[model samples]
Target chain A: MKQLVIHPERCTGCMQCELACSFVQTGTFQPSVSVIKVHVFDEQASMAPYTCFQCEEAWCMTACPVNAITIDNVIGAKVVLSEVCVGCKLCTIACPFGTIFYNPESNKAFKCNLCGGDPACAHACPTAAIEYEDSETKDWVGPWAERLNESFLTALAGEPS
Target chain B: MIAGWVGKVLKVDLSARTHEVQELNLRWARDFIGGRGLGARYLYELLQDPTIDPLSPDNVLIFATGPLTGTNASCGARYMVVTKGALTNCITTSNSGGHFGPELKFAGYDLLIVAGRAASPVYLWLCDGEVELRDASGVWGKGVWDTDDMLREEVGVPDARIASIGQAGENLVRFAAVMNDKHRAAGRSGVGAVMGSKNLKAVVVKGSGSIPVADQASFLRSQWKKKASLRDSKGRQNFTQLGTSSTLMPINAIGALPTHNFLQTVFDGAEKISGERINDDYVVAHKACFACTIACGRVSKISDEAGGRFLLHTSPRNWKMAGEGPEYESMFGFGPEVGVDDPEAIIAAHWLCNDYGMDPISAGATIGAAFELSQEGVLNGTEGVLEWGDAGKMLQLLEDTAFRRGLGDEIAEGSKRMGEKFGRPGVAMVSKGQEFAAYDGRAMQGRGLSYATSNRGACHLKAEVLRADYKDPGHEGKAGQVARTENQISALDSSGLCLFLNSGATYDDYIAEFNSATGMDLSMDDFVTAGERIWNLERLFNLRAGITPADDTLPKRMLEDPIPTGPRKGMVSKLGEMLPEYYDLRGWPEGIPSQEKLAELGLEAIA
Candidate 1:
């Protein structure tokens, strides 16, 4: 499945992604409504674009007691159904990354749905800081996931078989 | 209004400690637009008596934002601070790019006009529609950064952005600057001195509201396309790599670097102090303003061993903070103009100006004038102190000038005043009272005309004739070129967009952006017409202040001293031939705008 990925070093802190996200969802220029956030560090030397990682376990989807959140198979994107949402904001708290947010205007939780397989944030990024690609094929993510799994197995083995 | 504009004006009177709200005049908005255009109109209205002192209680300061300021627009974070100039006797308007402009728009005001004078030092805090003047006695004497921090603490809003002046402004240095964001500045025409004179130290703003746009859907789509266009443009690459300092090598290559005051048009050691050198030597990171797609700002630091020794030797105050920059103008002002080729030394000088709140252009030009005068045996008792290319002495002089100590006191008054005191009135390379910026007009004829005819005195940004002149070095059609550029720049300034964007975008692009945000059906012709109107209005204001055709001419050195070398060798700016054509193109009869032109713009009553 395709997933949104970021190359933080390429980021210029322009916030074009945030503007694009806000415009697509909120119909206005609002940074608060943006699902993707660009945080500047080192006195603006480096910028890191952070967004929903769409984990395999899908913590937000499991935390949504109202069954308002679901992952689309085609894009591997966690989407919030506004119609079913009760504005409980449980998913916002459950998401460890804090990428899932409860937009005050919409009164519902929102996260990057990858724009039905084409994310606007990736499209709008001037420096290619954000990208959309197959998650398994991307070399960086594949190794990261494998390393995480290996660490989990090692911990389990050491616990005492 | 569907465009991203709040369409309101806020007026504050310091003496009465009262505030009022008024609708932005629609006709003015349509014709003059916002930012510099709005600032010009407000200044013209407030300063009817040209004889009024610039630092007097009656002098008004207008902080204005344009229609495109607070949108998802590329490089839209800009604003203009317009008032009577303390450095130059003429009208002054300085533009700055930062988040303050966008915040002001989000707070729902197009313009904020400050009139009268406070009894004591104070800072104005603005949040949404509310405004208040708070006592700032504690932070009054502090530098810009500390004052900003203290204000944020006092207001209990850590995110509140502040624009403040430093000791140079408090001491009434003629070229003191207003600094914001610890780095960006409204750094010309002594606007900070005016702020200090009024006993106003800072203005902090925190806005948490949206700027309503007329056609939200269209605006969003247009903004998206603009981001892509900007990303693909060549100008963005140049800016990303070399920043504004990119112009340094090219200008130097063309023999227009303005070395050793204006006595010579070329610097021999230009390569060492060029923009490429700065990037290779010191630049650690690139920066951007709020919501800007083009991150052209360079955040650089020089190593302690490289040029750090100069900082240690000169002033103990600015020891180890990462020095801000040697931007193109600062590089020229402190580098070639004064004959100093050390990049690290240039960086130190740049930091000194920022820390003490001095405009580097004015400070460097003033020192250059003093250097020239001392060389000619004109200055009083400067036998061993003055020497060309002496970085240590230059750094020492910069410190003195910032603190108004010793020789710095004389230089603090500016080049024009310094020359007058030394009994050589014409030696200062200045127009009106403000010193000329980095460009030398002998090689670039159009830039020469721009410097001469600039409203705020010898400012290149007001009217850029370099590109046109670059295409054709000869003075053919330069007048028309200067006039057209001046109009376009005026429009851009008023619109609160960085002029750098104009490299990739056209007037139509700006018009589309403006229309998208303001919901005003403004055309390219209408936008250009507004620029023309603003240019003429500024000219009229200067005329009323007693500036004449004579003031619209270059210094004798630029016209008489031929460029000694380079491609355009043995050339001088033919201002005598160009001025008449420039005046005619501007629709001014014999260097002064006709009463009919003023009447057409509703400025006839003031005339």
Candidate 2:
């Protein structure tokens, strides 16, 4: 299955992905409402655009009280049916990645639906930091998280990592 | 509500501790568009008495964003700070690109007009359209980097964008700058000094609003096309790969580096501080501003051996590992202009300018003027204190200038004042009390004209004549070209777009984006006409403020003293030859706009 992959090293923190994602989701250029977000580490001069990894476990789907979240057979991606959503943020709390967002204006949970197959973020990224390619579902953040952990430990120890 | 503009103007009177949200004037928005032009219009309206001191409470400070600001358009991240300049005593519009402008727009304000001085040091905090004037004592004396971190933590908004001044601004240095995003600067013409005079330390914004577009489909297509063109352009590739320092070697080769306070037109040590050197030795990563496809920002680190050099009494921050710049302008100012060749030293000074919130161009030029005065034995009791190529002294002077200590006090007054005090005014290579940029007038004749007639004193960004000047180093037909280019640039500056995009995109591209985003059916000619209107309005402001036709001139060195050595040796800027033609082209008799010209631009009522 095709999955969205992020190369954090390539991100320059321009927020173009967020701009595109928000336009697709909110019908206007609003980064605050974007499901995908770019986290900037100014001191370290680093940035990364992160979104839902689309894990096979589908924790948000399982955590939903109602059947508002359903899997699309064509794309095998979880989609939010806002019409049935009761404005409860149970799924937002249940997600480990914190990718799913609760929109106050719309009062609905919105996450990266991969644009049903061709994600707008992946397409909008100028540096190709975010890419959609066919692969088995894997933990994309594991390596980045480990590097960040190493840096933190190094700073604490007063030594270079 | 307008499609592109948020349609709200936030007016704050610090002295009265009051605030009001006024509707943005739709008529002014259509005429000036926004940013620099709109800001100028507002200033013209507010400051009816043009002779008021720039640092006085009467001088209003405006922070304006164009209609395209905060949008998904490529490089749509510019904002303008317009006020009477403390340095030049002329109407000044300083432009910057970062997340601040877009964030301001997202906060639903098209303009933030700051009038009256605060009773004490204060910072303005705008959170989703709500306003607060908080005590800034905690971060009042701090550097820009420290202030940025502290304010973000204090506001407790992780995503807040802050525009703040530092010690230089606090000390009222004539060329102090307003720095944002920690590294991006609305740098030039002493806007920060004005902010400092108002007792305003910083303006923090956290926005959660949307920018509605008039034609989403058309805007998207036009913006993408611009992005793709930039992606394919060699200029963008060079900027991304090497950053702006790429221009150093070429400018140096053209005999326009202006070394040793313009005593020489070229620097022999140019190769050592070139962009290739920085990229090969120091660059840690590349950076980009908000929505910018051309990631020209350089994030570099000091070498381990040289890291201990140029130490300051500041808390540890990014300078230990990585920081942005030594851009082309900074490299020129801190490197060849001051005669320092060490890339590490240039990087250190550049970083110091960013942290201290100072304009490196004027700062380094002021130091260069001092060096020349010392060399000429004009400055009293300066035996071993000042000299060319003294990197250690250069760094020390930068710190001293920021804090207004010793010789730094005189230097902080700017080169023009410093030279006059030392009884050698000719040593100051300045125009209209502001120091010149990197290029030497002798080698680039058209640039000479641009510098002489620049609305905000010696500025290079106001006009586009480099290609013509570089192609033919003569005083022929430059006046008409410069007048035309200035109008186009005025329009571009007001459009909330990066001028660096001119490397790949044209005015047509900008016009297309503007038309689609704002739903305005303006042709290329109409857009250029808007720019002409803005240019004339600025000229009127300057004339009223007592910057006469005589002020439209270069320094004595640029006009009379020929370059002593280099390819263009024995060449002088022919201002006398071009001024009349330029005035004629501008329809300004003796540099004063005629009544008919003002009427044509629909400014008869204002005039």
Candidate 3:
């Protein structure tokens, strides 16, 4: 299966991925509406494009009362059925990654659907920081978070790593 | 409504503490395009009394975003700060790239025009669709980095982009820069000083709105295509890898890098402080502005030992190991121009300028002039402090200048004023009271011509002639080329695209993007004509500000003094031969625009 992979180290914080993702989500260019977000760490001089990981045990899909959230068999992306969504707050609360967002304009929950398997963000990213490829499903956020925490801990201890 | 442009102008009066939203004038928008040109149009109308003091309450300050700003167009992160420059007393249009510009558009404003002075220090906060003036007492005297952190925390919007000034601006340093995103700056002609005079500390913005285009499909297609071209472009690759610091050695090789305040053309220390060296030793990561395909910003870290050598009194927040810059201009200003080759000091000083919110070019150039003055026994009270290649004193001067302390008070007035005060106007390497960029005019004749006539004064970005001048380096037939290139660049600047895009894309690409985004069909000639209009408008503003046609010339040193050593030794700028031809090409006989030419550019009604 083709999965979305994010290499946070390669991101330049240009926000082109967000711009492209928003254009796919909403017709107009709006970062606020974009499913993908680039979290900037100015102190560390790093940026990471983060979104839904489509975990096999997807909490958002389980939390959906209206059965509006389901996984695509081919791409493994948990897709949101806006037509059937009740605009509940449960899925947002259940999601561990906090990638799922409530669209006030549409009154529907939205997350990265990988742009129907041809992700706009992966295509738009200039540095190839975000990629959609056939790879083993892995924990992208855990490694990035560990690296960030390791740096923070090193700085706190006043020791060179 | 124009699709690309937000079509809303926010007018704020600091004295009255009132604000109003006005519709953007479509006719002027078409003529000026946007950003620098659009801001010029509004400023020309609002600031009718061009002779007013730039630092006075009467002067108007405008922050304008181009039509392409906030769009997915490649390198769409630019905003123009147009006002009467406190340094030059001439109309200045300073451009900067970062998220600030796109955020302003997302906040639903195309331009923010500030008029009058506040009774107390204040910062403008634009959130969602509401504009408010907040008391800035807490962050009033803070450095830009601190101000950014404080304002973001105060506004409770961590992601909000902030453009602010530091102590340099608060003290009204003549060459103070308005820094955005903490590191990027609208960094020329004392726009920050003008903001300081208005008692404005910062402009903090958080936006959530969308920018709808006239043709979404076409805009996406054009942007993607441009990005693909940039991917293959050698210029883009060089810029991405080296981030402009690469130009230091080449310009030095051509004997164009002004060393020790234009006394020499080449620097022996160029290789030590070159871009390659910085990339090899200091660079930790590459960064970029909004939607920028060319990730040319260098995020570098100085070692604890190397950083400790500078001993700058900066906040702990700014003492972080990694920061952006030491761009080519700053590298030259803080490097060869001052005869310093210590890359670590250069990086440290670059951070000092950013934290202090100052233009490194003017600060270093002023120090350069002071060095010569002290050397020649023309300056007093500076026995050992103003010596060349002294990195410690250089950093000390930067802090002092920002705080307006002791000798820094005089240095803060800029080199032209400082030199004239010392009874040696010829010592300053400035044109129209603004310091020259890295390139020495003597080695690049067309660059000299551009420097002399740039409306904002001694700016290299106003025209594109570096490649041509590098090839020929002569005065012959440069008049027409400079004139034509200036028009094209003026148009490009107003369109809200990065000038660096010229590396991969053509004028036709910009025009196509503009047409698709704004729903306005303009040919290449029409686009250039709009630029021509913008140039003339700025010229008229400068003239009315009492800058005479005679002021359209280079400094005395550039014209008479041959480069003392290296590749272009014995070379002097032939500005005398080029100026008249340029004037004729500009349809400005005697350097005043002809009535017929004004009519042709649709400026007759105003001129």
Number of colliding residue pairs in each model: 7, 0, 0
Write the residue-wise lDDT of candidate 2 on B1-607 in tens digits. 4578988999999989999999999889899988999999999999999899999999999999999998988889999999999999999999998899999999989999999999999999998868999999999999999999999999999899999999999999999999999899989999999999999999999998999999989999998888889889988898789877888888888787899899998899999999999999988888888988888888988875565677743522557857899798889888888899999989888999999999999999998888888778766653365778998888888888999887889999999999889888888888888899999987998899999999999998999988898778888999889999999999989989988988787777898899999988899899889999999999989988989989988888998888998888899999899989999998998788999999999999998
Stretch of 10 with least lDDT, candidate 3 chain A? A135-144
Range of the 10 consecutive residues with the lowest summed lDDT in candidate 2 chain B? B309-318
- Candidate 2: list runs displaced more than 4 Å: A136-161, B313-317, B381-383
When 2 and 3 are scored with DockQ, the better candidate is 3
True contacts kept of each: 0.55, 0.78, 0.84
In terms of docking quality, how is candidate 3 classified? high
Compare the candidates by lDDT and give the number of the best one. 3
- What does DockQ give for each predicted structure? 0.37, 0.77, 0.83
Give per-residue lDDT, candidate 1, residue B538: 88
Docking quality level of the chain pair in candidate 1: acceptable
TM-score of model 2 vs. true structure: 0.97
Q: Considering only chain A, what is the TM-score of each predicted structure?
A: 0.82, 0.85, 0.87
User: Each prediction's Cα RMSD?
Assistant: 4.9, 1.9, 1.7
Candidate 2 lDDT at B80 equals 95
Candidate 3, B333-418: lDDT as tens digits: 88888889999999988898888899999998988888888888876674464778988888777778889877788889999999
Model 1 clash number:
7
Segments in model 3 whose C-alpha atoms lie over 4 Å from true places: A138-161, B313-316, B382-385
